[model samples]
Target: MQKGAAERKPGETDDELLHKVGTGNWRAVRLLDYPVDRILEAAGAWKAQAAGIVKPWLVWCAHPDWAVLQQKLVLSAGWTPIVGFDPRVSHVPIVPGSLRIDFNEQLQLPLMYPHFPVELAFMWIDKIAFWHSDFLLAHDMMERVATQFESLPQGECFVTHPGHPIRTRLKWLLNAKDARYWELLGCTTKEASKSQWDNGTSWWMNFQDHPNCPDKVEYERRAKCYYDHGSGIRYWHQKCGGRVRFIYETEIAHGHFTKIGNPDFKRSIPAGQSDSLRLMEQDMSRNFGLVEAAKKMRIEDLLSSD
Candidate 1:
Protein backbone atom coordinates (compact mmCIF):
# COMPACT_ATOMS: atom_id res chain seq x y z
CA MET A 1 0.00 0.00 0.00
CA GLN A 2 1.21 3.52 -0.72
CA LYS A 3 2.27 5.42 2.41
CA GLY A 4 0.08 8.31 3.51
CA ALA A 5 1.40 11.75 2.58
CA ALA A 6 4.33 12.55 4.90
CA GLU A 7 3.32 14.94 7.61
CA ARG A 8 5.63 17.83 8.43
CA LYS A 9 7.77 16.37 11.19
CA PRO A 10 8.89 18.65 14.03
CA GLY A 11 11.77 20.99 13.07
CA GLU A 12 11.22 20.33 9.37
CA THR A 13 12.01 23.58 7.55
CA ASP A 14 9.24 25.12 5.47
CA ASP A 15 11.39 24.98 2.31
CA GLU A 16 12.08 21.29 2.90
CA LEU A 17 8.40 20.53 3.40
CA LEU A 18 7.46 22.59 0.35
CA HIS A 19 9.92 20.62 -1.74
CA LYS A 20 8.61 17.36 -0.30
CA VAL A 21 4.90 17.98 -0.80
CA GLY A 22 4.79 20.85 -3.29
CA THR A 23 2.04 23.52 -3.28
CA GLY A 24 -0.75 20.98 -3.81
CA ASN A 25 -0.80 20.27 -0.08
CA TRP A 26 -2.61 23.36 1.09
CA ARG A 27 -2.20 22.27 4.70
CA ALA A 28 1.59 22.21 4.36
CA VAL A 29 1.82 25.59 2.64
CA ARG A 30 1.58 28.15 5.42
CA LEU A 31 0.87 31.34 3.52
CA LEU A 32 0.53 33.94 6.25
CA ASP A 33 1.76 34.19 9.85
CA TYR A 34 -1.07 36.45 10.94
CA PRO A 35 -4.78 35.60 11.12
CA VAL A 36 -5.46 36.49 7.47
CA ASP A 37 -8.34 34.01 7.32
CA ARG A 38 -10.03 35.98 10.08
CA ILE A 39 -9.38 39.24 8.26
CA LEU A 40 -10.73 37.86 4.99
CA GLU A 41 -13.77 36.48 6.78
CA ALA A 42 -14.39 39.91 8.20
CA ALA A 43 -14.02 41.37 4.72
CA GLY A 44 -16.58 38.89 3.45
CA ALA A 45 -19.01 40.04 6.09
CA TRP A 46 -18.37 43.67 5.23
CA LYS A 47 -18.80 42.93 1.54
CA ALA A 48 -22.24 41.46 2.21
CA GLN A 49 -23.42 44.86 3.42
CA ALA A 50 -21.33 46.74 0.80
CA ALA A 51 -24.06 47.05 -1.84
CA GLY A 52 -23.80 50.40 -3.70
CA ILE A 53 -20.45 51.05 -1.99
CA VAL A 54 -17.15 51.41 -3.78
CA LYS A 55 -14.81 49.01 -2.05
CA PRO A 56 -11.16 49.24 -3.08
CA TRP A 57 -8.36 47.01 -1.82
CA LEU A 58 -4.99 48.71 -1.35
CA VAL A 59 -1.59 47.09 -0.81
CA TRP A 60 0.79 48.83 1.62
CA CYS A 61 4.52 48.39 2.15
CA ALA A 62 7.07 50.61 3.93
CA HIS A 63 4.57 53.50 4.23
CA PRO A 64 2.35 53.37 7.27
CA ASP A 65 1.79 57.13 7.42
CA TRP A 66 0.63 57.20 3.85
CA ALA A 67 -1.56 54.18 4.50
CA VAL A 68 -3.32 55.96 7.32
CA LEU A 69 -3.94 59.03 5.19
CA GLN A 70 -5.11 56.95 2.27
CA GLN A 71 -7.47 54.99 4.52
CA LYS A 72 -9.00 58.18 5.84
CA LEU A 73 -9.43 59.52 2.32
CA VAL A 74 -11.10 56.30 1.26
CA LEU A 75 -13.46 56.51 4.20
CA SER A 76 -14.27 60.16 3.61
CA ALA A 77 -15.07 59.40 -0.01
CA GLY A 78 -17.69 56.87 1.16
CA TRP A 79 -15.72 53.88 -0.06
CA THR A 80 -14.61 50.86 1.93
CA PRO A 81 -10.84 50.47 2.24
CA ILE A 82 -9.27 47.04 2.46
CA VAL A 83 -5.57 47.39 3.21
CA GLY A 84 -3.02 44.61 2.76
CA PHE A 85 0.01 45.64 4.78
CA ASP A 86 3.57 44.60 5.45
CA PRO A 87 3.59 43.37 9.05
CA ARG A 88 7.08 44.77 9.51
CA VAL A 89 5.68 48.30 9.50
CA SER A 90 3.94 49.71 12.54
CA HIS A 91 0.21 49.02 12.64
CA VAL A 92 -1.68 51.67 10.66
CA PRO A 93 -4.21 53.56 12.75
CA ILE A 94 -7.29 52.95 10.67
CA VAL A 95 -10.89 53.55 11.73
CA PRO A 96 -12.80 50.64 13.14
CA GLY A 97 -14.47 48.27 10.59
CA SER A 98 -11.73 48.68 7.99
CA LEU A 99 -10.13 45.36 7.03
CA ARG A 100 -6.34 45.19 7.40
CA ILE A 101 -4.47 42.06 6.29
CA ASP A 102 -0.84 41.63 7.34
CA PHE A 103 1.42 40.13 4.68
CA ASN A 104 5.00 40.40 5.97
CA GLU A 105 5.00 36.81 7.19
CA GLN A 106 2.72 35.48 4.45
CA LEU A 107 5.19 33.96 1.98
CA GLN A 108 8.83 33.21 2.73
CA LEU A 109 9.91 34.98 -0.42
CA PRO A 110 11.67 38.20 -1.34
CA LEU A 111 10.22 41.53 -0.19
CA MET A 112 9.22 42.35 -3.76
CA TYR A 113 6.65 39.55 -4.08
CA PRO A 114 3.64 41.53 -5.38
CA HIS A 115 1.33 38.72 -6.50
CA PHE A 116 -0.01 37.24 -3.28
CA PRO A 117 -1.64 40.35 -1.81
CA VAL A 118 -3.42 41.19 -5.08
CA GLU A 119 -4.42 37.57 -5.59
CA LEU A 120 -5.74 37.45 -2.04
CA ALA A 121 -7.94 40.49 -2.70
CA PHE A 122 -9.25 39.09 -6.01
CA MET A 123 -10.17 35.79 -4.37
CA TRP A 124 -12.57 37.57 -2.03
CA ILE A 125 -14.31 39.85 -4.56
CA ASP A 126 -15.31 39.51 -8.20
CA LYS A 127 -14.92 43.24 -9.00
CA ILE A 128 -12.16 45.05 -7.12
CA ALA A 129 -10.14 48.25 -7.37
CA PHE A 130 -6.50 49.11 -6.58
CA TRP A 131 -4.74 52.39 -5.95
CA HIS A 132 -1.19 53.39 -5.17
CA SER A 133 -0.54 54.64 -1.64
CA ASP A 134 0.88 57.87 -3.04
CA PHE A 135 -2.34 58.80 -4.81
CA LEU A 136 -4.95 61.19 -3.37
CA LEU A 137 -8.40 60.39 -4.63
CA ALA A 138 -10.80 63.15 -5.55
CA HIS A 139 -13.98 63.02 -3.44
CA ASP A 140 -16.09 62.13 -6.49
CA MET A 141 -13.61 59.65 -7.94
CA MET A 142 -15.45 56.53 -6.89
CA GLU A 143 -18.74 57.93 -8.21
CA ARG A 144 -17.07 58.68 -11.54
CA VAL A 145 -15.56 55.20 -11.74
CA ALA A 146 -18.92 53.60 -10.96
CA THR A 147 -20.59 55.65 -13.69
CA GLN A 148 -17.93 54.61 -16.20
CA PHE A 149 -18.20 50.96 -15.24
CA GLU A 150 -21.95 51.10 -15.69
CA SER A 151 -21.64 52.51 -19.19
CA LEU A 152 -19.03 50.08 -20.49
CA PRO A 153 -20.06 47.16 -22.63
CA GLN A 154 -19.80 43.76 -20.95
CA GLY A 155 -16.74 42.97 -23.04
CA GLU A 156 -14.69 45.99 -21.94
CA CYS A 157 -13.35 44.73 -18.62
CA PHE A 158 -10.78 47.13 -17.14
CA VAL A 159 -10.91 50.92 -16.58
CA THR A 160 -8.29 53.49 -15.57
CA HIS A 161 -6.79 56.83 -16.65
CA PRO A 162 -3.85 57.52 -18.88
CA GLY A 163 -0.49 58.29 -17.28
CA HIS A 164 0.36 61.97 -17.00
CA PRO A 165 2.79 62.52 -19.82
CA ILE A 166 4.73 65.17 -17.87
CA ARG A 167 5.16 62.90 -14.87
CA THR A 168 6.21 60.01 -17.09
CA ARG A 169 8.84 62.15 -18.79
CA LEU A 170 10.08 63.43 -15.45
CA LYS A 171 10.45 59.90 -14.09
CA TRP A 172 12.45 58.80 -17.11
CA LEU A 173 14.76 61.81 -16.82
CA LEU A 174 15.24 61.35 -13.06
CA ASN A 175 16.09 57.67 -13.44
CA ALA A 176 18.33 58.09 -16.47
CA LYS A 177 21.43 57.47 -14.39
CA ASP A 178 20.16 54.15 -13.08
CA ALA A 179 20.94 51.07 -15.15
CA ARG A 180 17.76 49.46 -13.83
CA TYR A 181 15.68 52.03 -15.72
CA TRP A 182 17.25 51.10 -19.04
CA GLU A 183 16.84 47.41 -18.33
CA LEU A 184 13.21 47.93 -17.27
CA LEU A 185 12.26 49.95 -20.34
CA GLY A 186 14.10 47.45 -22.59
CA CYS A 187 14.90 50.01 -25.24
CA THR A 188 17.93 51.61 -26.82
CA THR A 189 16.05 53.98 -29.14
CA LYS A 190 15.21 57.44 -27.78
CA GLU A 191 11.59 57.19 -28.94
CA ALA A 192 11.09 53.87 -27.16
CA SER A 193 12.69 55.29 -24.01
CA LYS A 194 10.31 58.26 -24.15
CA SER A 195 7.16 56.16 -24.52
CA GLN A 196 4.64 56.70 -21.73
CA TRP A 197 2.68 53.88 -20.13
CA ASP A 198 -0.65 54.11 -18.31
CA ASN A 199 -0.50 55.07 -14.67
CA GLY A 200 -1.99 52.29 -12.51
CA THR A 201 -2.92 54.61 -9.67
CA SER A 202 -6.66 53.91 -9.60
CA TRP A 203 -8.20 51.07 -11.61
CA TRP A 204 -11.01 48.55 -11.31
CA MET A 205 -11.70 45.30 -13.10
CA ASN A 206 -14.31 42.60 -13.24
CA PHE A 207 -11.94 39.67 -13.47
CA GLN A 208 -14.72 37.11 -13.86
CA ASP A 209 -15.75 38.70 -17.16
CA HIS A 210 -12.25 39.54 -18.37
CA PRO A 211 -11.76 37.59 -21.61
CA ASN A 212 -7.98 37.39 -21.20
CA CYS A 213 -7.95 36.51 -17.53
CA PRO A 214 -4.95 34.36 -16.72
CA ASP A 215 -4.95 31.30 -14.52
CA LYS A 216 -3.35 31.47 -11.07
CA VAL A 217 0.02 30.09 -12.18
CA GLU A 218 0.30 32.45 -15.15
CA TYR A 219 -0.83 35.42 -13.09
CA GLU A 220 1.75 34.73 -10.39
CA ARG A 221 4.45 34.17 -12.99
CA ARG A 222 3.70 37.57 -14.54
CA ALA A 223 3.61 39.21 -11.14
CA LYS A 224 7.04 37.79 -10.32
CA CYS A 225 8.32 39.13 -13.61
CA TYR A 226 6.96 42.57 -12.64
CA TYR A 227 8.84 42.52 -9.34
CA ASP A 228 12.06 41.29 -10.93
CA HIS A 229 11.95 43.31 -14.14
CA GLY A 230 9.48 46.21 -13.63
CA SER A 231 7.24 44.98 -16.45
CA GLY A 232 3.79 45.18 -14.86
CA ILE A 233 2.33 47.69 -17.36
CA ARG A 234 3.62 45.69 -20.29
CA TYR A 235 2.15 42.50 -18.89
CA TRP A 236 -1.27 44.09 -18.28
CA HIS A 237 -1.36 45.73 -21.71
CA GLN A 238 -0.51 42.50 -23.48
CA LYS A 239 -2.86 40.35 -21.40
CA CYS A 240 -5.82 42.67 -21.92
CA GLY A 241 -5.11 42.64 -25.64
CA GLY A 242 -4.18 46.36 -25.52
CA ARG A 243 -7.82 47.10 -24.83
CA VAL A 244 -8.14 49.38 -21.79
CA ARG A 245 -10.43 52.39 -21.47
CA PHE A 246 -9.44 55.69 -19.86
CA ILE A 247 -12.28 57.20 -17.91
CA TYR A 248 -12.74 59.90 -15.24
CA GLU A 249 -10.17 62.49 -16.18
CA THR A 250 -7.54 62.92 -13.43
CA GLU A 251 -9.50 61.37 -10.63
CA ILE A 252 -6.29 60.76 -8.71
CA ALA A 253 -3.39 63.10 -8.07
CA HIS A 254 -0.01 61.59 -7.31
CA GLY A 255 1.85 62.97 -4.30
CA HIS A 256 5.07 61.44 -5.55
CA PHE A 257 7.71 61.93 -2.81
CA THR A 258 5.47 63.40 -0.11
CA LYS A 259 3.17 60.40 0.05
CA ILE A 260 6.06 58.09 0.83
CA GLY A 261 7.30 60.46 3.60
CA ASN A 262 10.49 61.08 1.72
CA PRO A 263 10.87 64.75 2.65
CA ASP A 264 14.08 65.16 0.73
CA PHE A 265 13.41 63.06 -2.35
CA LYS A 266 16.50 61.06 -1.40
CA ARG A 267 15.36 58.10 -3.46
CA SER A 268 15.12 60.13 -6.66
CA ILE A 269 17.87 62.72 -6.43
CA PRO A 270 21.64 62.46 -6.42
CA ALA A 271 23.25 63.42 -3.11
CA GLY A 272 24.64 66.89 -2.54
CA GLN A 273 23.09 68.47 -5.61
CA SER A 274 21.98 71.92 -4.48
CA ASP A 275 19.74 72.44 -7.49
CA SER A 276 17.95 69.18 -6.95
CA LEU A 277 17.52 70.01 -3.26
CA ARG A 278 15.96 73.39 -4.12
CA LEU A 279 13.63 71.86 -6.67
CA MET A 280 12.52 69.15 -4.23
CA GLU A 281 11.83 71.74 -1.54
CA GLN A 282 9.72 73.81 -3.92
CA ASP A 283 7.68 70.82 -5.05
CA MET A 284 7.25 69.49 -1.53
CA SER A 285 6.22 72.86 -0.20
CA ARG A 286 3.30 72.93 -2.63
CA ASN A 287 2.36 69.21 -2.60
CA PHE A 288 2.76 68.43 1.10
CA GLY A 289 0.32 71.22 1.98
CA LEU A 290 -2.36 69.57 -0.14
CA VAL A 291 -1.81 66.22 1.57
CA GLU A 292 -1.82 67.85 4.98
CA ALA A 293 -5.09 69.68 4.30
CA ALA A 294 -6.79 66.47 3.20
CA LYS A 295 -5.43 64.61 6.23
CA LYS A 296 -6.61 67.36 8.56
CA MET A 297 -10.11 67.33 7.12
CA ARG A 298 -10.34 63.57 7.60
CA ILE A 299 -9.10 63.84 11.18
CA GLU A 300 -11.68 66.48 12.00
CA ASP A 301 -14.45 64.43 10.46
CA LEU A 302 -13.44 61.36 12.45
CA LEU A 303 -13.43 63.36 15.63
CA SER A 304 -16.73 65.08 14.94
CA SER A 305 -18.49 61.87 13.90
CA ASP A 306 -17.56 60.38 17.25
Candidate 2:
Protein backbone atom coordinates (compact mmCIF):
# COMPACT_ATOMS: atom_id res chain seq x y z
CA MET A 1 0.00 0.00 0.00
CA GLN A 2 1.32 3.44 -0.86
CA LYS A 3 2.25 5.36 2.23
CA GLY A 4 -0.34 8.10 1.57
CA ALA A 5 -2.33 6.53 -1.23
CA ALA A 6 -5.55 6.33 0.81
CA GLU A 7 -5.21 2.60 0.29
CA ARG A 8 -7.35 0.48 2.60
CA LYS A 9 -6.01 0.09 6.12
CA PRO A 10 -4.61 -3.19 7.36
CA GLY A 11 -7.34 -5.81 7.95
CA GLU A 12 -9.80 -3.36 6.36
CA THR A 13 -11.28 -3.43 2.89
CA ASP A 14 -13.50 -0.80 1.37
CA ASP A 15 -16.37 -3.27 1.57
CA GLU A 16 -15.80 -4.43 5.14
CA LEU A 17 -14.79 -1.27 6.91
CA LEU A 18 -17.43 -2.07 9.46
CA HIS A 19 -16.25 -5.66 9.95
CA LYS A 20 -12.57 -4.73 9.78
CA VAL A 21 -13.05 -2.18 12.49
CA GLY A 22 -14.65 -5.01 14.43
CA THR A 23 -11.08 -6.20 14.84
CA GLY A 24 -8.62 -3.50 15.98
CA ASN A 25 -7.11 -0.71 13.93
CA TRP A 26 -6.66 2.68 15.50
CA ARG A 27 -5.60 4.52 12.36
CA ALA A 28 -9.21 4.60 11.26
CA VAL A 29 -10.25 6.43 14.42
CA ARG A 30 -12.78 9.01 13.24
CA LEU A 31 -12.94 12.39 14.95
CA LEU A 32 -9.15 12.02 15.13
CA ASP A 33 -8.98 15.78 14.81
CA TYR A 34 -11.76 16.65 17.27
CA PRO A 35 -9.27 18.48 19.51
CA VAL A 36 -10.12 16.50 22.58
CA ASP A 37 -7.17 17.98 24.42
CA ARG A 38 -7.91 21.36 22.93
CA ILE A 39 -11.64 21.44 23.76
CA LEU A 40 -12.72 18.68 26.14
CA GLU A 41 -9.65 17.55 28.15
CA ALA A 42 -9.66 20.37 30.71
CA ALA A 43 -13.32 21.27 31.27
CA GLY A 44 -14.82 17.92 30.22
CA ALA A 45 -11.57 15.98 29.63
CA TRP A 46 -12.67 13.84 26.68
CA LYS A 47 -9.31 12.62 25.32
CA ALA A 48 -8.09 9.05 25.86
CA GLN A 49 -4.49 8.04 25.36
CA ALA A 50 -3.89 4.74 23.58
CA ALA A 51 -1.28 2.18 24.55
CA GLY A 52 -2.03 0.54 21.18
CA ILE A 53 -4.48 0.53 18.28
CA VAL A 54 -8.19 0.59 19.16
CA LYS A 55 -10.88 -1.29 17.29
CA PRO A 56 -12.75 1.33 15.33
CA TRP A 57 -15.74 -0.96 15.35
CA LEU A 58 -17.05 -2.75 18.43
CA VAL A 59 -18.63 0.26 20.10
CA TRP A 60 -21.36 1.08 22.62
CA CYS A 61 -24.82 2.68 22.15
CA ALA A 62 -25.00 5.63 24.52
CA HIS A 63 -26.38 9.13 24.82
CA PRO A 64 -23.84 11.93 25.11
CA ASP A 65 -23.13 13.26 28.69
CA TRP A 66 -22.28 9.58 29.25
CA ALA A 67 -18.92 10.10 27.59
CA VAL A 68 -16.88 9.12 30.60
CA LEU A 69 -19.09 6.07 30.96
CA GLN A 70 -18.75 5.08 27.28
CA GLN A 71 -15.02 5.82 27.11
CA LYS A 72 -14.32 3.93 30.31
CA LEU A 73 -16.10 1.02 28.66
CA VAL A 74 -14.15 1.50 25.45
CA LEU A 75 -10.83 1.85 27.27
CA SER A 76 -11.29 -1.40 29.06
CA ALA A 77 -12.66 -3.27 26.02
CA GLY A 78 -10.14 -1.87 23.50
CA TRP A 79 -12.43 -0.14 21.01
CA THR A 80 -12.85 3.34 19.61
CA PRO A 81 -15.23 5.48 17.55
CA ILE A 82 -14.68 5.45 13.84
CA VAL A 83 -18.13 6.88 13.22
CA GLY A 84 -21.05 8.34 15.16
CA PHE A 85 -24.74 9.33 14.58
CA ASP A 86 -27.41 10.70 16.88
CA PRO A 87 -31.01 9.44 16.61
CA ARG A 88 -33.13 12.57 16.26
CA VAL A 89 -36.11 10.47 15.19
CA SER A 90 -38.39 11.13 18.12
CA HIS A 91 -41.87 12.70 18.12
CA VAL A 92 -42.54 14.38 21.45
CA PRO A 93 -39.02 14.79 22.77
CA ILE A 94 -39.83 12.08 25.26
CA VAL A 95 -39.10 8.39 24.92
CA PRO A 96 -41.11 5.89 26.96
CA GLY A 97 -37.97 4.41 28.50
CA SER A 98 -35.38 6.95 27.45
CA LEU A 99 -35.41 9.92 29.81
CA ARG A 100 -34.85 12.68 27.26
CA ILE A 101 -36.75 13.34 24.02
CA ASP A 102 -34.82 15.22 21.35
CA PHE A 103 -37.00 16.50 18.52
CA ASN A 104 -35.17 18.22 15.65
CA GLU A 105 -37.96 18.92 13.12
CA GLN A 106 -35.47 20.04 10.51
CA LEU A 107 -34.07 16.54 10.91
CA GLN A 108 -33.04 15.70 7.41
CA LEU A 109 -30.78 12.67 6.57
CA PRO A 110 -32.04 9.06 6.51
CA LEU A 111 -29.22 8.16 8.89
CA MET A 112 -28.61 5.37 6.39
CA TYR A 113 -25.79 4.97 3.88
CA PRO A 114 -24.04 7.99 5.32
CA HIS A 115 -22.28 9.83 2.52
CA PHE A 116 -19.51 10.86 4.83
CA PRO A 117 -16.22 8.97 5.25
CA VAL A 118 -17.88 6.83 7.82
CA GLU A 119 -17.90 3.03 7.90
CA LEU A 120 -20.52 2.69 10.60
CA ALA A 121 -23.05 5.19 11.90
CA PHE A 122 -24.01 3.57 15.20
CA MET A 123 -27.80 3.63 15.70
CA TRP A 124 -30.02 2.52 18.58
CA ILE A 125 -33.09 1.11 16.87
CA ASP A 126 -34.39 -0.40 20.07
CA LYS A 127 -33.67 2.70 22.09
CA ILE A 128 -35.34 4.83 19.48
CA ALA A 129 -38.23 2.37 19.67
CA PHE A 130 -39.61 3.85 22.85
CA TRP A 131 -40.15 7.15 21.05
CA HIS A 132 -42.60 5.28 18.84
CA SER A 133 -45.69 6.23 20.76
CA ASP A 134 -47.33 5.30 17.44
CA PHE A 135 -48.52 8.82 16.67
CA LEU A 136 -45.96 10.42 18.94
CA LEU A 137 -42.66 10.05 17.16
CA ALA A 138 -43.49 7.95 14.10
CA HIS A 139 -44.07 10.80 11.68
CA ASP A 140 -40.96 12.64 12.76
CA MET A 141 -38.93 9.47 12.60
CA MET A 142 -40.21 8.68 9.09
CA GLU A 143 -39.50 12.21 7.88
CA ARG A 144 -35.91 11.89 9.04
CA VAL A 145 -35.28 8.30 7.95
CA ALA A 146 -32.03 9.41 6.29
CA THR A 147 -32.85 8.56 2.67
CA GLN A 148 -36.34 7.03 2.83
CA PHE A 149 -39.68 8.82 3.03
CA GLU A 150 -42.99 7.08 3.81
CA SER A 151 -45.75 9.70 3.73
CA LEU A 152 -47.36 12.46 1.61
CA PRO A 153 -46.36 15.80 3.22
CA GLN A 154 -42.69 14.94 3.23
CA GLY A 155 -42.67 13.85 -0.39
CA GLU A 156 -45.11 16.42 -1.78
CA CYS A 157 -43.30 19.13 0.12
CA PHE A 158 -40.42 18.45 -2.28
CA VAL A 159 -41.76 20.64 -5.08
CA THR A 160 -40.30 24.10 -4.73
CA HIS A 161 -41.51 27.51 -5.85
CA PRO A 162 -38.72 29.39 -7.62
CA GLY A 163 -36.38 31.30 -5.26
CA HIS A 164 -38.08 29.68 -2.31
CA PRO A 165 -35.35 29.34 0.32
CA ILE A 166 -37.72 27.36 2.45
CA ARG A 167 -38.29 25.15 -0.55
CA THR A 168 -34.53 24.92 -1.04
CA ARG A 169 -34.16 23.82 2.54
CA LEU A 170 -36.97 21.36 1.99
CA LYS A 171 -35.28 20.16 -1.16
CA TRP A 172 -32.09 19.75 0.79
CA LEU A 173 -34.05 17.60 3.16
CA LEU A 174 -35.23 15.38 0.32
CA ASN A 175 -33.82 11.89 -0.03
CA ALA A 176 -34.19 10.15 -3.40
CA LYS A 177 -37.58 8.70 -2.43
CA ASP A 178 -38.99 12.07 -1.49
CA ALA A 179 -37.44 13.71 -4.51
CA ARG A 180 -39.57 11.49 -6.71
CA TYR A 181 -42.70 12.95 -5.19
CA TRP A 182 -41.88 16.33 -6.71
CA GLU A 183 -43.24 14.77 -9.89
CA LEU A 184 -46.33 13.33 -8.23
CA LEU A 185 -47.11 16.93 -7.39
CA GLY A 186 -47.32 17.43 -11.21
CA CYS A 187 -43.86 17.30 -12.75
CA THR A 188 -43.23 18.12 -16.42
CA THR A 189 -39.56 19.12 -16.35
CA LYS A 190 -36.54 16.85 -16.44
CA GLU A 191 -35.07 18.27 -13.22
CA ALA A 192 -37.85 16.85 -11.08
CA SER A 193 -37.86 13.31 -12.51
CA LYS A 194 -34.25 12.65 -13.38
CA SER A 195 -32.89 9.66 -11.52
CA GLN A 196 -29.45 9.89 -10.03
CA TRP A 197 -26.87 7.30 -9.06
CA ASP A 198 -26.22 6.66 -5.42
CA ASN A 199 -23.07 4.54 -5.62
CA GLY A 200 -23.11 3.68 -9.32
CA THR A 201 -25.29 3.60 -12.40
CA SER A 202 -26.46 0.12 -11.43
CA TRP A 203 -28.22 1.79 -8.51
CA TRP A 204 -29.76 4.73 -10.40
CA MET A 205 -33.24 5.73 -9.32
CA ASN A 206 -35.74 8.62 -9.11
CA PHE A 207 -37.89 10.15 -6.36
CA GLN A 208 -41.58 9.22 -5.74
CA ASP A 209 -44.92 10.14 -4.11
CA HIS A 210 -48.50 9.30 -4.99
CA PRO A 211 -51.91 9.89 -3.38
CA ASN A 212 -53.18 6.45 -2.48
CA CYS A 213 -49.94 5.48 -4.11
CA PRO A 214 -49.09 1.94 -3.11
CA ASP A 215 -45.56 3.38 -3.31
CA LYS A 216 -45.04 2.96 0.40
CA VAL A 217 -45.90 -0.73 0.20
CA GLU A 218 -42.49 -1.43 -1.28
CA TYR A 219 -40.93 0.68 1.42
CA GLU A 220 -42.90 -1.22 4.03
CA ARG A 221 -41.61 -4.42 2.54
CA ARG A 222 -38.04 -3.16 2.86
CA ALA A 223 -38.59 -2.10 6.45
CA LYS A 224 -40.23 -5.41 7.30
CA CYS A 225 -37.33 -7.20 5.67
CA TYR A 226 -34.88 -5.38 7.93
CA TYR A 227 -37.19 -5.19 10.95
CA ASP A 228 -40.14 -7.18 12.21
CA HIS A 229 -43.69 -6.95 10.87
CA GLY A 230 -47.12 -8.28 11.83
CA SER A 231 -50.66 -7.95 10.50
CA GLY A 232 -52.53 -8.99 13.65
CA ILE A 233 -51.78 -5.60 15.28
CA ARG A 234 -53.61 -2.27 14.82
CA TYR A 235 -53.38 -0.27 11.59
CA TRP A 236 -50.73 2.21 12.75
CA HIS A 237 -48.74 -0.66 14.17
CA GLN A 238 -48.44 -2.10 10.70
CA LYS A 239 -47.95 1.17 8.80
CA CYS A 240 -45.50 3.15 10.90
CA GLY A 241 -44.19 0.07 12.61
CA GLY A 242 -46.40 0.84 15.61
CA ARG A 243 -44.22 3.79 16.45
CA VAL A 244 -46.90 6.27 15.52
CA ARG A 245 -49.89 4.47 16.92
CA PHE A 246 -51.79 7.74 17.02
CA ILE A 247 -52.18 7.54 13.27
CA TYR A 248 -53.93 4.24 13.76
CA GLU A 249 -57.14 5.89 14.95
CA THR A 250 -57.08 8.74 12.44
CA GLU A 251 -58.90 8.35 9.13
CA ILE A 252 -56.73 9.08 6.11
CA ALA A 253 -58.47 9.64 2.81
CA HIS A 254 -58.40 7.12 -0.05
CA GLY A 255 -56.64 3.77 0.29
CA HIS A 256 -53.72 5.08 2.27
CA PHE A 257 -54.62 2.19 4.51
CA THR A 258 -52.55 -0.28 2.50
CA LYS A 259 -49.30 1.01 4.00
CA ILE A 260 -50.32 0.29 7.57
CA GLY A 261 -48.79 -2.61 9.50
CA ASN A 262 -47.99 -3.68 13.04
CA PRO A 263 -44.84 -1.93 14.10
CA ASP A 264 -41.91 -4.15 15.03
CA PHE A 265 -41.29 -2.39 18.30
CA LYS A 266 -38.88 -4.20 20.61
CA ARG A 267 -36.90 -3.55 23.79
CA SER A 268 -33.88 -4.73 21.87
CA ILE A 269 -31.99 -1.51 22.70
CA PRO A 270 -30.73 -0.13 26.00
CA ALA A 271 -32.24 3.29 26.72
CA GLY A 272 -32.40 5.55 29.80
CA GLN A 273 -29.03 6.81 28.55
CA SER A 274 -27.55 10.20 27.85
CA ASP A 275 -28.59 12.70 25.06
CA SER A 276 -25.71 13.73 22.71
CA LEU A 277 -23.28 10.82 22.86
CA ARG A 278 -23.21 7.89 20.40
CA LEU A 279 -22.33 4.28 21.26
CA MET A 280 -20.66 1.51 19.29
CA GLU A 281 -21.51 -1.51 21.45
CA GLN A 282 -24.96 -2.48 20.11
CA ASP A 283 -23.89 -1.68 16.56
CA MET A 284 -20.73 -3.71 16.89
CA SER A 285 -22.52 -6.65 18.41
CA ARG A 286 -25.30 -6.47 15.82
CA ASN A 287 -22.77 -6.65 13.01
CA PHE A 288 -20.31 -8.95 14.76
CA GLY A 289 -22.89 -11.63 15.66
CA LEU A 290 -22.46 -11.13 19.41
CA VAL A 291 -25.64 -9.98 21.12
CA GLU A 292 -24.41 -10.18 24.70
CA ALA A 293 -20.99 -8.67 24.07
CA ALA A 294 -22.24 -5.06 24.01
CA LYS A 295 -24.41 -5.43 27.09
CA LYS A 296 -21.59 -7.14 28.95
CA MET A 297 -19.22 -4.37 28.08
CA ARG A 298 -21.69 -1.77 29.30
CA ILE A 299 -22.30 -3.72 32.50
CA GLU A 300 -18.62 -4.34 33.13
CA ASP A 301 -17.89 -0.63 32.86
CA LEU A 302 -20.85 0.26 35.05
CA LEU A 303 -19.68 -2.26 37.68
CA SER A 304 -16.02 -1.29 37.35
CA SER A 305 -16.86 2.35 37.91
CA ASP A 306 -18.35 1.73 41.29
Best by TM-score: 1
lDDT of 2 by residue, 59-177 (tens): 11223323233333333333342223234222112111122211111222222111111111111110111110011112222224311222222111122122233563376466312
Ten consecutive residues with minimal summed lDDT in candidate 2? 126-135
**Residue 228 lDDT in candidate 2:** 13
For model 1, residues 1-306, the per-residue Cα lDDT tens digits are 221222345666655443321111222333222333643354355334434544444435335555666566556655566666533334556665466654433243222122233333333344444554444544465456545544444222343333454564476456622111111001011111112112221011111111122354443343233222223333444443433454322334332334234564433345543221123223434455544645543343433333
Q: How many backbone clashes does candidate 1 have?
A: 0
Q: Estimate each model's TM-score.
A: 0.45, 0.20
Candidate 2, superposed: residue stretches over 4 Å from native: 1-55, 58-70, 87-306
Model 2 clash count equals 37
Each model's lDDT comes to 0.37, 0.22
- Supply the TM-score for candidate 1: 0.45
RMSD of each: 13.1, 21.6
Report the error of model 1 at residue 176, Å.
15
